[model samples]
Target: MNLKQEMSHSPQTVILHQHPLTVHTCHTVVVGSGAASLNAADTLHRMGQTDIALVTDGMNRGTSRNTGSDKQTYYKQSTSFTDADSPLKMARTLFNGGAMHGDIALVEAALSLKSFYNLVGIGVPFPHDTYGQYVGYQTDHDENSRASSVGPLTSRYMTEKLEAQVRRNGTSLFDRHLVIGIITTPGENGDPAATGLLTINMEAIDDTGYGLTLFNCRNIIYGTGGPASIYHRSVFPKSQAGATGIALEAGAKAHNLTEWQYGIASTKFRWNLSGTYQQVIPRYVSTNANGGDETEFLEDFFQEPTPLLDAIFLKGYQWPFDSRKLLENGSSLVDLLIYIETQVKGRRVFMDFRRNPRCADEQGTLNFDLLGETARQYLTNSQALLPTPIERLKKMNPLAIDLYRTHGIDLEQEYLEIDVCAQHQNGGLAGNHWWESNVKHFFPVGEASGTLGIYRPGGSALNATQVGSYRAAEYICHRYTQPPTTTDTFLAQAEHLVQHRLKLLKNLVVNPEQPSNVLAFQQELQRLMSRSGAFIRSRPALAETLHRFQDELARFPNQIHICHLKELPAVFRVYDMLIAQIACLSAMVAYDERQGDSRGSYLIDHEEGTHRISHQGMHFAFSLDRDFRDQVCETFVKLDPPADSPDTKQTTDAAVAAAKVTHQWVKVRPIPEYTTWFENVWADFRDQKIFDEKRG
Candidate 1:
């Protein structure tokens, strides 16, 4: 069958209510086909909306492998002393870890333990005990029964299961179709109502690459995933190419764009041990000059003295020093470290584990065992890391084992050599608890929406996707009143956008210098972000970084030419750089205003007393609009400060009296002026042409 004929005969077309070219229509159009998107589609179909289509840039080998192995294990679950360890406690931890930037309502929604269990019930195969209690495990920073893994492949497994469900629901899957932009029209309150989508059918050979196809719908969900691919090293698949950039280009305002997380480690290779090749692991922690562990810095700031000591305190054990008081200094310590590392060192300082000889051997053993077990399981069951067969991996990726033998690094090692790598961006399309962006009828979910704020807890990505998607569906299904069909203005606007995008795509293909510019800009942006914005924060570095970013913006359009339409990879790179710039500016401003010691990742240094301390009552500033102008601002509330006991207050009062110091207590100002910090970030982004070009 011909391409058009095949599409017409496809099951997806059979379920559609109108022809593909229809002007005014209502059909379900999912912008992504990832786990979240699939869930949205299933839910909509269950709600009786069968006129749907799932669009994506064809599945890659990574999609199935993305979910790690299904080996389930159990461990003791503990809570941080600050958290009561209840569901509410988990929610609070997520907020604090996120710098109190996530939506409280969404957090509350995600606290439902049943949500995780539901996935399990739907064939997720979560690890469980004989009595059926869910298995839990401990990770790097989590405190609480927060994580349960069905091996490393939990994400991939869940996605496949969701995809299966989507198919069963009769929802059309448009593989290899990319959503270029959202089709929006102004609503009653000047909000842009997302009525449909503008897409490119990449499958057709005759596809001019300029033909803009519109998929009309009352609601649009962006499950386009995170922007981690912009970084040099990332765990995400290459297919996750930051489609949110296109969304942002289409008038979506992303919040928390200035809080990109860095420091991640991915498996580099595997080794052979016990007649089996193991996955060789690399060292993956950030460190300082003295080689006194950087984690020690966090410990000192938190006043725990050590990780085990902190664990002990969390168990209600008391120590000689007040750990709570010590943690208050964490923020300052982080800032000081950043200043020293970036401004003084001139070279990237990392917690290098390559110096540890044990890294290679330990990692190798672990990799061999893991692969052997996985291979065994795959042979037993027809499934082996999704579509890739175990036999094929053994034949095709022999270097995975060869690299380990040649290098000392093995995957079994507990401590791997690690360095700070650029992580997830905290900012994306700005949204409320409902997942509704500034643009009406448009919903941003997962990493695409900066709803979770500065830092997300270990498993919060799953939580965010589930809750955000559910809430977005709820909002559109409940709150919206379908607009009249006679409104040709909405469809007309979509048509115009389609044409404009086509022209841009054409220019991209025809332009000669775009590819080189893209590569150059990408390198420049990565260097700038790494040098000034990576782990630590300081004013001088931040200012210089901003200047560099601005320079890039000035040189980008003129120097780069986008000739090959397929070479639009630079668009995402440019988008990520701009996003990173915003995040760095915001973080820098916050660090400048913050007076205390280091807490968590937001660190600054002070001369005396304990170096590490956690700051209480810190809040991040967010805007509903993407322009980040001063006009639209809101401060989300965070955890309350530690309360003083009656005895402590009385003792303080008595000490004051004993000193015989007659003093007037002046009203203290709220520290870390959020508004000023926000303005700095906004102005930095606004001053750049990148923002303007995107806005236009």
Candidate 2:
């Protein structure tokens, strides 16, 4: 097959339901425009696989472009001359984060520098000293100083640079194209493998058949990010409605679906309150819903100011809410207290940078000398022992203050409303060392892939995204470089699915009296997930929650009625979220049945209530499970045919009930203990046998 000629082939148009739908045949379809997706296209092009197209919901949207902290971290192998770091040592650090596969960890570590330098070569501007060594700092869960950054918008720079490279490489771009489904057919082992994608072009949504389009590809790099659209309280950009659900419905398994990272963030302008924002020690205050009658809330819980001050300072690097920190007056108590004030008490919480945290004994005065050793030393080192939080922030990181200003916020004078919100998912679609899923030819990279486990170093996600894309692209070039299935063969397999979807689409528009309730349904889904499936879970409440979600799932499409053709994208998005939510809730219920305890970032509420924390006048109790960090929770969805309904032809209620989701607990794969003997390893490298190992 001539790769260059394959890249030049234009899409063929197929008439289905009297609509001319465009079908582009390619070797690979990279589904997303984020850093990982763009890097996949560019890397595949560089590796000589030119027949690829980049499809995305939006060009300038995604967490990678819109989200960050005061100084967003990028975890990599230490580059400082004084630090002792190697691929093996770094792999151990990542592998020690419970439930992560050893082979993936090793691959990520082994290729960390190669990925980092690739970004550098593309002009990402990672900081380096005069000696040409990239200096680093310590981030959460990291023992060594392996973190680096380019200010708060590190990922933004990365996306911009990689996007430029991808455009320069002349890879095809499908902007504003939402992937509604993954087309699959039986492959090598007679199991379903990714064959193509079914998409809707938003630009032509008002046209006939709602602008349906298709991609006939041999492989797919799924990088649509985490299932952020599932939660109401999320830091993910509004545009990032992840398409992981469609893949799950296509027979992909999920790993560690219950693990997530939640942190206190400014609710008004969604951004993480990590690094300098917390280190400055701002006052935690709450007010009535109308934003009056302000009271210093944290003062009521702490007898003295030092412990409270120290906790707030630790929130800088401590960042994500860890259940372990909730015990013994640790940093996570701040998140719990805030959760109680805002969620339980029905009040609004904010961080007032203008004033110091108040205490009964302190009398509204902050004494730098009374702070704990950690806080005192850190502040002293940064020369930030200033009077107020804003002043300290201005001195420590002016960029933090400016970032908010760009978003119509004046942090210097106004209060930053904050709440404990979902920041990132540690779990997502399950994949192997090369980022390939259980279904052959489908690769989930970046946050879309559940590679990271319970506790990852702060910026390791950025690194993993790059490394996973490289591995996926490399694996494809080496062993899977074959021409895509003929268009006729693809149409033969996809015709029925396309016709079914078109029937649903026509029904949505033709029934004008039903009205489009997409927004309302989305809000309802978000509320359900945030209440039951965020960082805090109640075992008894989850069973009922799962039942409610299942019922909703059963009533989908019938329950959803859109009046216009333009609302098709939103209708499909809600459908995707519904599928994803059911599987996630199922995973949560399974974990609860296994007596999974309060560990990592979430707490499990149980009647046993072995652990207790008191906030305001209310006492909350939770059960603790024995350590199961060494185990991985994997989930798979089995699709059953829709049951027959006598009243209506579209019995989606039966279809919802047909999705039988199941989960299992298995021991986590250990890091490979392989021989490093040079000559022996060289033989395997020569034979290209290293990539074939299935140690994980």
Q: Point to the candidate with the largest lDDT.
A: 2
What TM-score does candidate 1 get on C-alpha atoms?
0.62
Q: Least lDDT summed over 10 consecutive residues: which range in candidate 2?
A: 1-10
Measured by TM-score, how close is model 2 to the native structure? 0.96
State the C-alpha lDDT per candidate: 0.46, 0.85
Q: How do the residues 1-696 of candidate 1 rate in per-residue lDDT, one tens digit apiece? A: 111111212222111112233232455466676666777777676665565566666654222324222121111223223334554445555555433432442344343464565577679887667766664644324566546765544667777887777766656666666566677777876866778776655544232433235566667888877664444433344445656555654567654444454432332421111111111112223355445544322233233323322222121111011112223341123333333343454323332222221212343222222233433353335332322212322442344433344446543332333223444555566675567777777888766765554445555556566667766665555555363233355556666665544434333324554334666657566666656555444456766776655444433333346555555534534644453354335445444443322333333333333433223332212111122111112212111222344565433222210001011111211112123366777786565422231221
- Kindly state the number of residue pairs that clash in model 2: 1
* Root mean square deviation (Cα) for candidate 1: 17.4
Candidate 1 achieves a global lDDT of 0.46
lDDT tens readout by residue for model 2, 31-125: 88778998999999999988898889998988899999999999999989888999889999998988888888888999999999999999999
- Candidate 1: regions farther than 4 A off: 1-26, 61-89, 96-111, 135-143, 204-211, 233-236, 267-417, 481-488, 506-517, 547-557, 569-696
**Which structure among the candidates has the greatest TM-score?**
2
